[model samples]
Each structure stands twice: as structure tokens, then as C-alpha cells.
Target chain A: MPYSSTIAGTRYTFPDLRTLLACASPPRAGDRLAGLAAETAEERVAARMALADLPLKIFLEEPLIPYEQDEVTRLIMDTHDAAAFAPVASMSVGAFRDYLLSDAATTESLRDLAPGLTPEMAAAVSKLMRNQDLIAVAKKISVVTRFRTTIGLPGRLSVRLQPNHPTDDLGGIGASILDGLLYGCGDACIGINPATDSAARVMALLQSIEDLRLRFSIPIQSCVLSHVTTTLDVIAKGAPVDLVFQSIAGSEAANRAFGVDLALLDEAHAAVQNLGRGPDGANLMYFETGQGAALSAEAHHGVDQQTMEARAYAVARRYHPLLVNTVVGFIGPEYLYDGKEIIRAGLEDHFCGKLLGLPMGVDVCYTNHAEADQDDMDNLLTLLGVAGCTYIMGVPGADDIMLGYQSTSYHDALYIRSVLGLKPAPEFEDWLTAMGIMDAAARIRPVTGETQKLLAALP
Target chain B: MTSAPPDDDPFAFLRAKTKARVALGRCGDGLPTTRLLEFQRDHARARDAVHAALDVPVLSAELVATGLPVPIIVQSLAPDRATFLQRPDLGRRLEESSSAKLEKGDYDVSLVLADGLSATAAQKQGAALCALIGKSLSFRCAPPVIACGARVALGDEIAARLGAHLVIVLIGERPGLSSTQSLGAYITFAPKPGVTWDAERNCVSNIGPEGLPLAEAARRIVAMTALAFGIGATGTMLKEDDALAMLEGPGNSSPIDGHRDLQG
Candidate 1:
């Protein structure tokens, strides 16, 4: 059914729900590139006005990408807990937004409401929120998961020590890992994006990091961010796999473009759980998602990038992932355009993911081609810190030499932790103090004799 | 309780192993001034590399000096830097006028020098690497095509137009803070326009002084081409490990030895 709204004297009409969502989305280059954005600012406001009045139940009635064609849509519809949605069943999208922001939306309420909220409903309500609203609500809810250590607890922020290397050289990767460990980072995990995706290379990298973890007896998990298929192959060959990682997308078609499906994810998830490497090991997947992923793959099916991104969170929540982050600015300027768009998209993804009951993190990064710099990253980093982000990448100096992008540095994590009074995962923090890398006050202490012993152990 | 001596470089051993910016002493949870400025400077260079235009005439002359045919200059559908950056699809197809410049010919390899993302890489490394690979390859090489506002996939369309068996695109990679002018090579067998997926191409990346040197990169590309021919495939089906073994064979020179010969 066509939706219409009036502003001043002009009547604006949307042909469908997808069109309404696209038009109502805050200005983003990806939506414009898809030729789905509102032509004028007034048209956008009109669409938003119309979307605000939309009944929350309309989303269930009108499947955005046809339930039969997209398994993601099917997943959303099939798995929705109607019992949990009963409180807000009769509310409009606008009222839902208000409900989320009000004091009544306590931690327990939001936790219960997660199963009831569809990705579309979450995306629609988020469209009506400001950045602060996104942050304030996200801060109220926490999604904790356990692998080697507990993550997403309140007053804690973890850093994925991304010690990526250009050649997958053991020495180079080990060096970066040591550097990250010294900065009191790597509580979330020590993940590496291998330069090559060869199965042999993936196995070698997995063994190398596992060796480090064992040698130091550190309470950490390690993952090689290779294709899920390659990771599965390594696991079959008896490699020490910790977290099964994959780059996931919102739409079924987009996920297909990435050479993944829900079935493949389920297979990988089961394989990793079988190893049972970490403590509990219940959360065994690490997923990286971003805006424009569906559009970039030419599989968005006319929906906006933001909504598609929220749907990705739906896929993530199904797997009970330990870590899921949006590599926000890594897709470049074509999708995000500038720092403002990147910052907003990061907030939105975090908000949606957290609301959908997932341990959400942000890569908080940008490519050189994008119109962003360290300062832009700084702004987003601080905002995500305030939003109760689960983790951020701790690259060498905010520079990923292999991936050719800038992410949060080890020091940047230190900065956020200092300002926000956030500690690392409890177990990892204990390890840091025991190793003399961090003081009791949660500050990185100056290099001492222990630092020398740590350096001597490097191969 | 005592801190290490001030002059001792605690991270020096690790720093020697990787190019990653690690272990610069921090100032109260922030980067010290020297390290911060260094980051900003490298970032600025990388940003400039992305926007900088290729010196086509100089690159063309350099290619010609290496005994290759005169280079054909062309532009992708994207008219300018901003458009090229914004519209990647436009960069994957040639401009109408530019497409009209090439004549259909049967060739073993269609080489493309593209100003992808970083024109600085194309300008600095394209000609030299082209010379090395052209000298080594036993196959018939067409005159190199210099593409402006180009993406890696543009080579597919160009090679398809020329009826070449394979396309090897030496394009500028996205600039990183540590290296602004690194070149990348994409090799695709059985070139097809608008039909090929990125998975159908094999990529060799991080080609520069600090990373993979030109001589070593050329050796690998030549080896990969041979393996692709052997298997009648290029992409995921062609194993790079086979190419590495071929390069390490008794007769083949080491990468360092090849570099020395090139310098001499």
C-alpha cells in the first residue's frame, strides 16, 4: 500500500514500505547512490513524518524483501517472539521511539523487548532518534557473552588486538601482539586479518597465535579473520581455532555475494563449538558488518543501507556471537561521504545491534580515500565509548599496515578507558596486573624488568 | 618497582620485525607529539596520493624506453577524481571515446596501467614494473594501455576489447599510512566485461620499496601467469604456492639477486 504525508500544502507519497524507509533515512551517500533517497530535504521530512505515524505491526504485515526470496526476512518473521512484543504491539513507530527513550525502558524491559523487536522495527525507530538518543538507550542495555573471558559487562570495554601483518609472517604478527599486550589491550581477542586467504597460511597463523597464548598462559582467544570456508578447512585439519569469523551482510543475496549463508554460518558455529577451546565457549563467532555492504554487493533489494545493516544484526544475534563490529568507515567515502555520515552510521549500527541483543562493537576506522582523519575517528571513538560499546580494534598506531586503513590505536583504547573509567575484561585485567603491564589504578605502567622478560620471550 | 633506563629501547626488538607503528612511548594515554605528527604527515601523504593525478606522458615515455610498443592513453567512464571515487561502477568501464581508440587484436596478454585510488603508485611504479614483466614474459604483449580514473576491473573490459587471453592490471592500491605509493597487480584469465566477479581474479598486493619490491613482484606475476596458463584458470583455482615453487627452482634467480641485477 502507498503511504502518503502532507507538509505545508504539498502531499508526499511513498510507493512502498522500502521506499518510505529509504526516503526517511538521514542523508547518506549509499542511499543516494542507490537512487532511493528523497529528492529534497522537505520530501525527506515528509517521509519521516509518514514513517513516524506507521503502525509498528505494519512491518510484520509488509515484508520488505518478500519472505520467500530472502531467508533473512524469513528469519526475522519466523523467530520473532510475539509474547515479548505484546507491550508495544499497538504503538506507532513514533511512539516506539518515545518508549525507548523514556525512563520506563529499563534494562530489564529492554532485555525482554529484544526478541519482540524486528530489525525493521528497530531501524524505523532508530531513524527517529538523535545520536544522543541512540547512545542513552544503548547505555541502558548490555549484552554479555563469554569465550575465554566475559565481555560486554557494564564499566568494561574490551579491545580486539588486531596485530595484522602484510605477509602473515609469524615474527611480525607476534611483534604486534606483544605491543598490544603491553598497552593492556587484547581483552576481547587477538584477531589477525591474514594478508592471504590460503588455507595453509590460515593454519600457520592460527598455530602461531595459539603458541603465544599458551607460552604466556594468557587468558585470551585468537582468531584468523580468513574466509569462513578457509577457517573451516583449517579446523578440519586440526588447527587450533578459537572464534569462527566471517563478514556477514543483511540480505540473503548480499550474504550469498560474500559466499556465505545461514547454513554455512550454522556449520561453522557448530564446528567451533565442538572444539570448545575457551571457558564456556558458548559464544564462538566473530562477525564484521558495515553499512553499504548490501548495496555494494548489489543485493539490497531497494531497501536503505541502514535498514539492511540492522538486519545483519538479526543474523548476528542468531549465532550468539562474542564480538560483532561495524567496520564503519572502512567501506570508503562513496557510502558514508564524510566524517559526519560515518559517525552517525557507527552510532546507528551500535544502537541497533545493542537493541537487538548482541555484543556490539565498532571498528571506529576510516580508509584514506574517505574524507576522514584521526580527529573524526577520535570523535566517533569517544561517542562509542560513551554509548557503552563492547570493543574496538587496537591496531599498532591506529594504522592497519596490511588492510591499508586506520583503526583505533592501542593508545586510543587506553585514552577511552582512562576517560570513561572502563576496565578490560575482568580476567584479562588480572593478567595485565600480574604481568606488570598495567598498574592497580588501571594505568599502563612504565617499562620495568618484567617488560624485559616479555621482550626476551619473542621468537 | 624501578623503571627501565631512559635510553633503553624496550620495543626495538619487536619494531625490527614489523613495519607496524608500535611501542612509541605514550603521553598520558595519547600519542606523544613526534609520533602524532609523524602519523599526520603519513596520513596527509596517503590522502594526497589518492587525489593526485598520474603523469601519463612521463609514464608512457618510460614504458617506451623499455622496448615496449607506444602506450595508448585512455580514461574510464568517470570523468574526474571525485566522480571516480564516488562511482566505482563508472571506473570499471571505459569512456566511449576512450573505448573507441583501441583496435581488436589477438594477444597473449593485455597489460593495463591504472591510476586506481592512488595515482602516485601508478606514476612511480607502473612503468618500472611493466618493463620488468615485459622483459621476462615469453608471451606476446600488446602495447600497454594507461588508464585514468580506473579500477581493477577496467582491465577486464580493455582486455576483452583487445581479445587477449588474459589481463594483468597493475593499479595503485588504496594508500596506507605507512606506504602511500604501493602498487597492486590483478590477473584474470578469460577476461569478460561486466560478467567477472572479483573472485575470478588473483591479486598480488603491497608492491613498493618497503613491501614487495618491483623485481620480486614481476617475478611472481610472471610465475603466476605461467601457472594460470597451465591450469587454464586464474583466481581461486590457481594455487600461488605452485608459482612460488616455480620461482624457487634451480634456474630462477632469487628476488634479491634479481633486484641487484636491475639496480646494476
Candidate 2:
């Protein structure tokens, strides 16, 4: 099958006009366009190589994330009652039995059991778990923040200052995560969601960073496609010809809002199709399978893992092979013994798991599968990509991100968690200085870049 | 290095200082040893840290793979770093044969695990975590491969030539440590080179020992392979019917608050 589309809907491919504008080693537009039309697998790789030749600074996502606030406590008080799964306590007989059988309870009981077998004590333990909420309290959670504070990433870091207008154009948190990646990967980028990636918003944000990149003699990273809304509305409005996939259905918002649903992709795809679009112009990419079915298990969805795998395989067979994306999101609790089921279901059977003969592309939440270490999370994220997630959404403060300055295709994930879970990390200051990213930080330090550096680096 | 003055919290500042050291090492950063806490922080993520620490880093995955070990390394092959993101092939092979001298041997199972594109993968257990694999598996084992630059097929690539019953690789997982540096394994009933990602591949991970143990990971992989055999799969033909059904299911949901209710 030849990939042919009318002018209104061209195949999503190559460097954005901005890449053309910012190319340090500019080719004749005629040659560039000609190559694009005749792009073979090798040519695409070549174009990608040429992309890397551009300054790393150009790729930085626009408008950094200002995570460090004097008053900014990284730990949010997550009241157990407010959580969607809070009802786990008001569990039915089935729920209690299931919990008992779960790895979490069996491996590590949720309750603080006592020697006393008194009914009162036993009842208290159950009630406590039912009412339980854990807080990761610390006098200071500044290691990571200090590092970022000293050495700012390529994106704009918004200090707590409220913009004069109710909304600032830079797209804030998502922008910052994307910008840093752009600066790191130096590839063509397109973000989903209005605040994250709208064409106008993207251009606006990039344009805002020109002065900064120039001060550093680097090009501002430009978004080839800045799409907003995971809803079919944006794609129908007119998909970007250069964009490949739209990373959508994030886990946090959906998980926080409802629970999870791994079996909703088919219906979600149908909804988009009902809107009258058949991936002809461009391909659609989903990050996690949850946006459609929020908190339903795979087996509960009337299918087993293999059935889901077949459908996923079928969907990839139907969509772009290079871009066979089944987005997955993570909320850490699922891996706690029996809590492992959701993690099990949310996982998209790695095409690599079956295709490449390796297990890859299953998105489980919580940085340290064992603990919450940003760097460790970055490593796992990177490994997952290699294992075969076309992309994995990640948090901004992930350590390996800045240290190695990596953003590989096979090992890519979105860093949306950065915005929603922005917490002050103290160690970021030392990392910045050690990695020599401090000077770069001052370049786009949205507010008080130089001043913050001095204060943070002070003994 | 300055010796630490005795203090109430011996590993405190360093522990604090090394927030996500595991991820940094796994995501193509240098093999991490400095600034790392040797033991697992939560008893759940790791079964026993001191035991893991005492074990040689080189043989950790095998010990972790006691039940069985499957090693793999997957990376993009694009030659340059910039292009690797767009071209995945580059990340799959080490620039040079860093493992050529990796004591070629024959045994019941030959295993090698690489971090391929994700460096944090290798460090999720912080150290090679040989003890995790060793303490769990009480069987004759082959030597292990713990390299910085590794790939998924490398396990089979080496094993294909090794002529072993099984060849497993547990490379550094790509960093996503906050999320996880999940270990991936490649298994072959009768190992040989030229095995593609589509053929005879089986894995067991999220093996936090407590959360998901290496021994249990072994159990699952063995189960996956046994099922693959019963179905008579040849890579692409293998039907992994319900291998990963629970991860995404809400009933399988594990909330962070340490408290959760039953689904149904």
C-alpha cells in the first residue's frame, strides 16, 4: 500500500518549518523538499542525523518548569478519603478476600497487626487501613530541586509568579518538560493538549524563547506540531502533516479522577472514527489505554491478556507499524502485592515482547518499583523504551534525563508528571553544577535565573 | 574520598544526596557505584539488600534468576546519539564488542542482561544485585554479563553461538526508575544465535523480590515458555494468551496511600 494523501492531509513527516529556519547547516529548500519526497529508511535516518547537527539548545522545550518554591513542598497531603481507590477499605467480602490473596497483603500486610487478638484491636487495624493515608513527610525535599535551581533545563521554569494575565502563553509545565527533551533529543517535536502542544501556543512559546537561545547562540527548539486535546476535535480540525502520533490519555488525571481502564482503546478509536477520520492523513498515538475505560480490569473487560494482545497487535497491524503506540500510564500503588493486577492489565503487551522476542513497553507507575528515586525512575523509563514502548510519559525531575541528556526514540516517554507533581528537589543544584548545566540554566531561567543560582549554590 | 565522621544517620546525607542514583546509572550514564545506597529502601522493592550487596555484581542477575534467568539488551541502532532516538537500531548494539572477552562459557543456562537504552534498568536494584538472583536460585549457573552498553537480542546473539539449553540476559534496564528499571529476559529452550526478537522470547519482571521477586519472575517466565511450547510457537506464532492481563486492570490497581479497597 502506498502512503498517498491529498494536499489537505499529507503524511506526517520530517523537519518543521522552524527546523528549516533554524538549521545551522541549512540545505537548499529545493534539496530538502526533494529529499523529503524521496525519503527512504536511510534518508530518514540521515535527516534525523542532520537534525542532531542542530544545536542541542534549539531542541529545548519552550518555557521551563519552575519546581522550586520556598513554600513549595514536593509532598502533597493525599488524604486517603479523597483518593478514588479509597473505597478499597469499605471493601466487600469479595474485596477483603481478594486483598488477602493479593501480593501486597500476603507479602506485606497493609495493617499494623498486633499480638492482641482482641476484636477491638483487630477491628481497629481494619479501620485504620480503611482510613489510611500515607504521607512522605520530610523537613526538606530539596536535593533534586537545588540541582534544577542551580542548573535550569532548556525549558522555561515558571516561578510561582502569577502571570499578569490569567493565562500565560508558554503552556507552562508541559512546555518545560517538552523543551528540556527538545534541547536534549534535538528532534522534531509535537505536543498534545492545548496547554501542552497547540500550534499557536507552540509557536508563541518558541518565539518567546528566541531571545534566550540567542543569548546562548543557540536556536530555540520549535515544535513541528503542537496539538491540543486528546479528543478527536483537534485531529478533525486538521492534523499536522509532520506530526507522527499524539501522546494522549495520561494516567494521573484519569487515575486521580477515576481509576483505570485498559480495554477502552477500541471504543475510543471508534469514537474518533465516528468523527469521520481514518488515520489516512496522519497516525494517532495513545499513551495509555485508560482515557476511554478509566478503572476496568482487562479480564473484567471480557477478555484475557492474550485477547487484548491480539487486539493490540491487530490495531498496530491496522495503524502505522513504526508508530504502533498503546499508551500506558502508571500510579505506583498497583504493584503492591495484589495491587499488581492493575499494573498487569494496564501493560500493553510489548509488540517487542512478542515481535522482537523481548518484553518491552509495559508502563508501570512509581519511580522506584521498590522506591521513589528520580534517577532510578529515569533508568527504568529508558530501559522500558528499549524494551519497546515507542514512548513512555515521565516526570521532569528524572535524573538520567539531565545527566546523560538522553531522549531516544525506542526509549521515549512523556514527562507530564513534572507539571502535576512538581516538588522541590534539593539535589538538583549539585547535579546542575556537576553536569555543567548551570550556565545553561541562567539562559532561560524564567524568573531570577542568576539570583536563584547564586542562592542555591551558596554553602 | 573523605571518611564520613560517625553520625546518627550514617548514610543519611549520602542517601539524600543520591536521590535517584539508580536511574542515573541505568540510563547510559557510567556504571553507577558512587552515591548509591547499597540496600533497597522499601522492603518491598527489594527482598534483601545486604545479601544483594555481598554478592558479586557480575553474577547477580543469575542469582536473581535462580528459578531461571533470561537476559536481554535492546537499543536503537542509529549510529550517532542524536539519530538513535529516531533510529532504534543504534541503541541495540554496543559500539564495540565490549563483551567479546566476557568469559565465554557453556552451562545449563547462559545469561547476560544489558541496560540497552535505559541505564537506570541495571541499577534499579542498585549494584548488579547478584545476591537477589543467587539467594533465590539454588542451581548450577552459567556466568553472567553485566555491561553498560547492552541489547535485548545480545543474550541470544551470544547464546546462539554458545550452544546452551537456555541463554538469558538481564541487562541494565533503560532508566524509568521513578516508574521502574524493569528487567527483560530472552529465553531459548535450546540456545543459539540468530534468534530474533520474534522467536522463543520469554520474560518475567517487575520482580521487586517483595513486589515481584526474581524467583517468581523465573516462575512466570518458565510458565510463559511452557505455555509457548504447548501452543507450539515459533516466535511470531507464539500466542501469549493472558501473559500481562493484570497490570492495567483497575482491580489490579495498587494505590500509593498504602491503603486500597477491593474492586468487586
Candidate 3:
């Protein structure tokens, strides 16, 4: 018996100290220390011996601190209360995970555990899960989902009209918005990022979208992602402010580059709440994140990019953002290296975000400088669709001239919906029907003459 | 097996004087354990700084206590941190309600305090710098305006509204890993809303304990403001010629002209 166990036809080998040390970074080391803080001297001695073979520098980096296990244990108990599962507290990490993956009945119970997972608890529990288990958890979480803002209702997948313009060119952006509307996008928000960082330009862009919404009676939301401050300005001006947008990262420095924090998010959320926009009093903030942002900002804390990306979900959860999508492959080859890494990161972010209780999505994108292409995005999009992604960026022609990248396109959305039997958000679907963009059968129809005339006049 | 002794902290000497990540060497393929831990700690601090809220009432009271001028409260269009981050242009302008409250006045210079990326920086450093600048100027200075959710260009709007000849905006700089609570000063002449480029401003950056000492930063700012007023221009044409070497106290030897190239 070489310290191996088999369950569900897959075997997991128990690790030696060296393997444990390699996997256990300083944060996890601190967590282990805290976990054992209240134990008896004898038990502490045993735990210490188990970790004693680690490099001395690892101990120096993380000081031993007292922590409350009851907090985590209580959360787990609460989750277990909701699910039909065996007591997992007494099991070792591997044993607990193996028990969960032993059969379909156990695998189906995984979603019950999601709400109870803090990043620390998740990291600990996840270490015991295989890649397949992670995917299984994602598959479970994505089914029958909706955002806090109620954009992605059951049986529907949301889409954002990212009519990005290189300059504050209203004509180009308006045309793109029209095209996206024609193709049944913007169930999420008509979010735009103007190239120029001017206040007037942002306001003008926002005002244009507001006009479009009012004129077309489009019940969806609109956002001009200039900066949080600019969005606030638009709101204060009594202009149409549907959702505030900002790029976020796991670490503080990366967020500093994005120029946002929890306080900023709270303030924006409060401001939007005061305005009382959107359906069912929905959340009024939208956030985007990427894997390499923290590392690029030099604030990743030596953690793996995936873990750092997961920590960012904690930040997003504070704001209760209506939308949270990772621009997974947009960071290029330096951080993620290749298509394989990109796909893994996309899945990891989706799983982690869903586990942390957020409406997760993916861009399914790649830049020209990256080691990815349409095929890579295609594979990711199909998987994400099956994984129940809340939404994806709907850009024209799968190429964002402003962002300088190729991403999932409207046709791709149609393809995914056809394969997955998903529809656009309910409210948006009604608008599409009214405009004759989609028929009673939910098939894309030829552009109506009236809608074409309206689009022609927009530019 | 015999193990190697822990590598000495290469930045130990510099760490005592500055928060800059100096002399931190790599171990294997990543940062040394000490450096990595410090990085995490610093990253947390920086995030905390960005998220820290400014107690506007308290800040207003403290500025009045400094006996310079009664601070006027103003607000940028950005209502919160998220909005401020998303809308840099909005941060540069005033909210409509605030615009209505800002009464126009003729003054030599309009001093503005804005909570930029770090509210902590603005609240802690604004009053002291204002007091120091007050000592050097004999001209009528506009009552200092403390604007929340503001950026450097917000001064332009406030100054234009006040009909001041020059505007000196003391705002928070973006928090770096090492230093989270650092202040910056941006001066513009004949400041207005449109047609103002980055090249048309003068900036004094990194004013905090870890960077430029407050007294020296204040002195340099006063000198530059006076020079700009005298020359009837600011920005690329303006230069910091006056030496305030005495203000740079012992152990404060970091470079101070970091913002010289900031202008377009």
C-alpha cells in the first residue's frame, strides 16, 4: 500500500512533505498555523512536525496567528444543513473530496457547498479536488442562474453590447450599438469605453445611449465606462446612468491602476440605489477583471494567478455587481503563456467566482499578440455556454478595433444558444420580438425595413 | 542535510529611510520570502488607503484650525469611489449642486484640496501644505476648497469659477505598493474647463513621509507658484529654479522631481 486511494475510478496519491511545501504558499501556511492554534500541545507538535521539513524562509514569511475554526466549520455546517450529505469535518481533505466525487448523487450535492466557501476555505477544500471535480462544480453552479440584478433569468444567457470606439466617435459607436441591437445583444448593458479620457466626451456618449434607450423604448441598461468618477458625474448631472463600470484586479495596486476600491464601489452602489434604476431594483454596478492585472501591477503577492483571480471575486462581491466577467485571454501570452493556460484560467475564474456567489462570465477573447485565435475562443465559448456563463461580450465581427482583439461574436452567440437551447434575457427577448429581429420561433430574421431605417439614421 | 543560511534582506538599509521596494532580490524564480510577505503587506496597505474615506467635516474643521483660510466644501461630479474611478472627466468637473454653491471671487490664487486616488493622503497632507504656502504668499488667496471625489483638473473648474489667476490643486496620487498615502500638487494658470492639456500644468509629486518631506514639498510648491504667477505662465515653460535645500532634512534624500515629465 503506497499511500494511494481510489474512488470514482480515479486515484489520488498522498503527498510527502516536499510536495506539500511546494503547494503550500505563505497564505496557506498562515491558514494552517491558525487552524492548529487552538489545538493541544501534543496535536500542535504533530502538525508542526508535518510542516517542519519546509524551508525555514516559508515560516519566516508567515507568522503564526490564532484563528477561529468554528467560523469556517459553522459555514460548512450551514451548507451541509441544506444538502443531503455526510459529515465531512472528520474526514481528511482528500477523503472529503473523494466522498463527494464517488457518484453522481454526491457530485450533484456540490452546489450546496458554494455559498459557504470563503477564499481560504475554498482554497483548502479545492486542493483536494481534481480538475474534473472543479469542472463538475462549475457545471452545477451555472445551471438555472441569474445575476443579483436579474439580467440572466432562467433559460436565458445575457449579452453586453461592447460598442467600443477608438475615439469618442458617436457615429461609429452608434452604428455598432445598432448592429448589436439588430443581432439581439445588450441584454446585459450597452457598455462603451471611449478612447479619450475627457469628461464631456463620456457624458456625450452616455447621453447618446440614453436617447437611444428612450427613443427605442429599450428596457435594457447602458454604461459609458470612462471612469467611475465620470459615471458619478453623469449620475449627478441627472443624466441617464444605468450601470457604473470599472476594471478590477485581485490586489490593491492593480485596482489602484483601475482607480477603484471597495469604498468607491459602495459609493457608486449607493448613488445608483438612490437613482433606483433597472428592473426589480437591481444592482447598478458592472465590473470587469483579468488574470494578469495583479501581476502586471506588481501586487500579486507571489500567489498563483488563479488564486489571485479568485480573491478578486471577494472584492466584486462587496459591490454586488450586476455583471462580473473575466477578460480571460485578453492579457496576452506573458501571463497565461498559451491557449491551454487560457482555457484553464477561464474555467478556474468561472468556478471560483460562482463558488464565491457571483454572476460569473467570460470574454472568450484573445488579442493579436496572444497565442490564441478564434478556435481557442470557440472551444472556450462552447465550454462556458455548457458551464452556464451569465453573459459574454457581443462585439461586431469578433474583432474589437479599439481593444485590438478577436472575441466571441453575435453569430457565436447564436451558435451557442442553438446548441445549448438558451435565449436572451426575457425583457430583451420581448424587445427583439417587438422589433421583428427575432420571430415567434426565436430565429434570427432579416432586418426589418423600419429597424434598418432607424439604424441608417443613427449615424 | 545541511541547509544554507537565510539570505540577508538586501533592502534593509534603504527600508529604514524609504518605503520604495529597493534591494529586494529574487529567490529561485520568484521574490524572496521576506520580500514576498512585505509585498503582500504593502499591497493590503495600498488597497486600504484607496478605500479609506475622508471625513469631510473633520477635514474642514482641521483646515480652519490651521488658521490659513476657512475651507469651502465642494464636490466633484463623481459621487463615489467607483464612479470616480470610471469617470476621470467627471472628477475634473463640479457637481451641479456644488457649482451653484461655489460663489465667484477674485483672488491671486485658488487653493484646492481634492481627494484623488487616496483620501487619506488629501486629509493628512492638505492642511499642512496649505499652511506652509500661506507663509510665503502675500497676495489674497481664495478660501481653500475641499472637494471630495475630485481629481487634479477639478481645480481648473473651481479656479475658473472663483476667477482666480492661478489654481494649485493638492490631490492624492495613485497609491503605490510601498507608499499608499502620498500627496501631489498640480498648478495651472488661467485654469478653465476645455483646451487644457497636461503640458500646460506643473506638478510636484510624492509628498509624504516616504518620499519628499512635507516642508520641502511646501517650499518648492510656494516657489513654483510665485514663479508661475510672476512669469504669467505655468506648465512646460515653468521651471523650479529656487533651491530649498535646507528644507530637505537629514535622511530625506529621495529624488523630488518625479513629476517634471508628467506634463505632455
Q: Pick the candidate with the highest lDDT.
A: 1
Runs in model 3 deviating more than 4 A are: A1-92, A95-112, A123-132, A142-149, B1-264
Go through the candidates in order and give the clash count of each.
Answer: 0, 160, 16
To one decimal, what is the Cα RMSD in angstroms of model 1 from the true structure?
4.6
Residue-by-residue lDDT tens digits, candidate 3, A226-255: 678777877888877777888877666567
CA-based DockQ, model 1 = 0.44
lDDT, candidate 2, B1-264, per-residue tens: 333333542112322322322122122222223323332233223222101211235435544455434333222233432233222233344434443444455555555555544344455652334444444333356655554333465555555444445655554332332333445555555544443543355544344422445555554444444544455442445433343232222222211111111100
User: How much TM-score does chain B earn in each model?
Assistant: 0.87, 0.47, 0.83
How should the candidates be ordered by lDDT, best one leading? Answer: 1, 3, 2
Interface RMSD of each: 5.2, 16.4, 21.9
What is the C-alpha lDDT profile of model 3 across B1-264, one tens digit per residue? 233224563223322332223233334223456644554565556656766778988888888888967788899887877556534556878889888767888798988888887788888887888888777777779888998888788888888888898988888776654566678888898887856776688788888986787888877777777778777888878766532333243323333343222311
Best by TM-score: 1
Query: Which scores greater on lDDT, model 2 or model 3?
Result: 3
| lDDT of predicted model 3 | 0.65
Task: Evaluate candidate 2 by giving its C-alpha RMSD to the native, one decimal.
Answer: 25.8
Per-candidate DockQ vs. reference: 0.44, 0.02, 0.01
Which docking category, incorrect, acceptable, medium or high, applies to candidate 3? Answer: incorrect
